[model samples]
Target chain A: MIKSLVSITGVALVCAALLAGVRYQTAPHIRANREAATWAVAFQLAGGPFPTNNVTLPLANLRIGGTRLDTVSTPGYGGSIEMLVALDRGSIGGVKVTRHEETPGLGDFIEGEWMNQFEQMQPMEVDTISGATITSLAIKRALQSHLRTALAETAPEGPPG
Target chain B: MTFRQAAIERNPAWVQLLGLCPLLAVSNSVVNALGLAFASTFVMAGSALIISLLRTLIPHDVRLPCFMMVIATFTTCAVMLLEAYTFDLYLSIALFVQIIVTNCMILGRLEAFAARQPPRAALADALGTSCGFAIALLVLGSVREIIGAGSLGAGLDSLFGPDAADWGIDFTDEGGGMLVALLPPGAFILAGLLLGLGRGIHEQRQARAHLRETEG
Candidate 1:
């Protein structure tokens, strides 16, 4: 009985030490990778004659050229869909699905040609993609709500128009 | 058994039917398949080594539980390392990653072979088994990805890095890839075909060997 207890404890302790060592080495790289991905997604939505030294705006928004880029998430058929919506002069410049959990073949069209409809239009004009109604609706609803909040927050700046 | 025999004649995936859940689920893409394969191999070999080292120290009554603890520890290490270094791939296979702890192949080997073998022999067996499993995953993943997307290596960038972004091949000029091949049923069909192929080859080899023996 005593030997069994001692052996179990020794093995558990060794395993814990090994895990701690690896966690220490990997934590920083993971953080940096996530940050880089977020930045890349934000810039890609902005669709620019590239901006030099794009300034960080308020409310998790980015200012690139004349466009303001922000990210939002909405519940979809499978899970949450995260999108980066770029606003140029109070109209939708472009919208990009940064991440999603819709059905891989059926509903993932939100990341494809279906999203092209949101380009250079008002958020209200966005339509649901055929056969992917739930995912498309999620993106549209999320974009409307986010646009409302963005507009309300920046109303004092004479609206991007 | 020799490594070649272990990998082919007694393959854990094809012949023994072990660890098929992740094999089918993540085999949609080569990168996902490779990621899971690497993790499984690491856990299998590490657990084999640790279990062999403690074979004598573990009491008979609690041996199974002890073996489980060792396998779980190695799996946790694999999970953390993947999450930290290959965050995208980790996210894609997170569900399958946790499932690896319960993969019968690891426990099966520990009970059937690792418990009785020396550390070196056990490690070699684990390596061979893992190689077999990896090969099966790669073959299934390639077939599925190519047919499903009309492309190969679509997500290599996630596994290798930015330099691999252009590695994907575009087979169709105007793309409308088959959607069914990316779904669950596709995995089932492809896996069954591969298993049948393995069995056919094995049977043919046996028949030829028997003929040679009878003539001799």
Candidate 2:
């Protein structure tokens, strides 16, 4: 009995040590990659070169050539959908679904060419796709909230003519 | 056993019918298939080596649970490594990777081969089994990706890197592609056809050998 206990404990300890070693070694690189990916996706949605160095919060206050870009997350059919919405003078410049977990074939229509419809429309007027209603609505709702926050932040400067 | 025998004649995927859940789930795309294959191979070989080395120390009653712990540890390591280096591919197949701990092929090898064999032989068996699994996944993934999407190597970029984004073939003009080929039924149908083809080839080889023996 004692032998069995000792052997099992030793093996478990060794396995734990190995796992910890790998996690420790890879944690830094993983964090760096994640940061780089966020910036890449943000830049893609922003459309062309932006002042990466000047941006305070890449996800919230992304400013590029008189346009403001903000990322928002909302629940989709499968999981949360992360969208990058570009705003220019109170109208949507462009909207891109940066990340989502919707069904591959069916719900993925939100990522299709049809998403161009969301561009140049007011957030409340954006229509959801037929089959992918939930995912589409998620993006719309996220945009609505982001627009509210963005407008309130710039509201102090008085209405731009 | 020889690598050839393990890979083909006594194949783990088709012949033994082991680890079919992952075999079917991730084989929808070549990149997903290759990612899972690499992760599984790493876990299988690592587990086999460690289990074989400690086989004598483990008590008979607790061996199964001990083997499982070892397999789970290796699987966790694979998941962490994949997440760190290949975040996109890791997200695509994270569920499958987590379930690798429960793969019967790994447990079966530990019980049937690893425990009784020396470390060197255990490593060879693990490699052979992994090769067989990888071959099966690649063949199924390629066939499904080509027929379903009307393109080959559609998502190679996810597995390789950004440079491979242009590596995918586009056949959008080929009559809109086959939706069924990318679904679950497609995996089942393709797997069945491949199994039949393998069996037919084996039978023909046996018949030729018999004919040569008679002529002699």
Candidate 3:
């Protein structure tokens, strides 16, 4: 039994040693990867391809210059999915799903080309992703807040378009 | 210990039912399920081998903790390897890969098999447990993926590299695929169906065996 204690302890020591050694080595790479992915997504969302310069989405660096959060939702297979879109300097700077209990695969309409549809569609136009009617409508309804905010910023006579 | 006994009797997911967390979570997609299954297999096998080899001297009092420590180590290594090499899968799987450390299957096998049996027996037990888990994951994954994504094993490039992009046969290629099945709710519904199906199969097999017994 004593021998067992010593043996197990030895294994513990080795594991701890490896953990101590490798965590530091991997952290930097993980951080970089996360940074790159975030920027790539943001760039794509900002109506541009990822830059070759490898710059991050400079949320902190860029002044807010004025921003508004608009709530949007569409019917999802699971339920209603509400999303919040951030308008910075009159452009769609950030978008996040606020309330979503969507079906795993079927309701993933928020991602991929489905989400991209929001870029071109008018807030009142209401674009739906074919089969994902509920999901797409939820997104459209959710965008009502953003539309309100847009209308508020631009008076009836002024063309923010 | 034959493979059959290990499967139906031991039944890692249902009978012993360890690792059900990941099984329940990732079983939404066959590819995700398979990725997890293979990684779990590697970790289980490695941990079992190491624990069994050192079982003789491990103090009874600390056996559980020591076993956990060993298993955690192998799981960590595999998790790191996956994240580093398989970035897309790593992205998709996210935290579930690390959560394998908490999987009762590996720990249960360690305590039950490695603590009591020889290294080879422990290995066999681990292999059996992994196989059963794999089978469960694959079935659930296939159902979910086929229903949700309209394709089985469609997103191969994310894991096996860009070359495997063509590996997945797309039903949507002809402009047809049920988009709803690809969401989270679809995963739950599909998994529930499979579980029910498994129960049905088990009941039929039992009824058949009972009939055979009567005839004999």
Candidate 4:
């Protein structure tokens, strides 16, 4: 009994040490990669790179021609679809699906060129994907609703025309 | 088990049908398949090594927990490496990679072979099994990518560096391929056909050997 306890403990300790070493070496690179990906989309949405060192997510006030970058989450076919939507001048400047649990191959269309339909559009008028109608409609609804609220709050003159 | 038997005859993906979840899910593209193959191979071999080295020390009753811990550690390592280096590719297949620890193939090898074998033999079995799985993944990935996307190595740049951006052959115009081939039903159909083909070849080889023996 004593030997078994000691052996398991030893294995656990060794495994933990090995993982800690790997994490220490790779953590910085992972962080940098994530930051780079997010910022690349941010720059693309703003139409140009702008300086903002400490911007938070889901509600980033990107000081670039009145662009409000916010994260939106809505129920998708498989699970929640979390997207980073940039609203510029009451229209979507750019949209990026940061996380989702939709069915692969079908619902994953949102991650590809299908998302481009939402760009530069306020009401998000686009046809739903053939097999992924629910996911597509969910994204359309979320973006349009968010845009309505955002426009209403900013303009203080009710919903947009 | 011999490398030949482990890698070809009693293969994990083909013969045992283990780890089919990631196999079918990530095999939609060659780059994704290779990425997963590399990660699975690393985790399997790494865990096998650690388990074999400590096999005698681990109590039989508590071996399962020990193996789980070891496998999880290696899987985590693979995840970190992929996220840091192949960020884009990793993002697409991140879910599959995270679940590598639960892959029955890895655990099966650990329990059936690694636990009892010496370090060298255990490592060999792990490598052989992983290679077999990789071959399955590559074949399925290639077929799916070709018929589904009309391209091979379509995302090479994501797995390799930027220099490999144009490495994939474009057999058709963009978005002109059969969409169903990239879907789950495609994976299932192709996998079933490939398995049947493998078994047919194996049976033919055995029959030929038996016929030669009788004639001699």
| Predicted structure with the largest DockQ when compared to the true one | 4
Question: lDDT tens string, model 1, A17-84?
Answer: 87788778878887766656656766567653444354442216677778887767789999988777
Of 1 and 2, the candidate ranking higher by TM-score: 2
Candidate 4 on B21-81: residue-level lDDT in tens?
9999889989999999999999999999999999999999899999999999999999999
- Candidate 2 runs further than 4 Å off: A1-5, A54-58, A71-85, A88-147, A157-161, B91-95, B150-179, B207-216
**Model 2 TM-score relative to the real fold:** 0.76
Instruction: Indicate the residue-level lDDT of A75 in model 3.
Output: 63
Global lDDT of each model?
A: 0.81, 0.85, 0.71, 0.89
DockQ values of all predictions: 0.42, 0.59, 0.26, 0.73
- Docking quality tier of model 2: medium
What TM-score goes with each of the models? 0.73, 0.76, 0.65, 0.81
Instruction: Give TM-scores of chain A for all candidates.
Output: 0.66, 0.69, 0.45, 0.70
Candidate 1 lDDT, tens digit per residue, B114-207? 8888899899989988899999999999898888878877778877888998898878877647888889999999899999999999999999
| TM-score computed on alpha carbons, candidate 4 | 0.81
**Which 10 successive residues of model 3 chain A have the least lDDT summed?**
A56-65
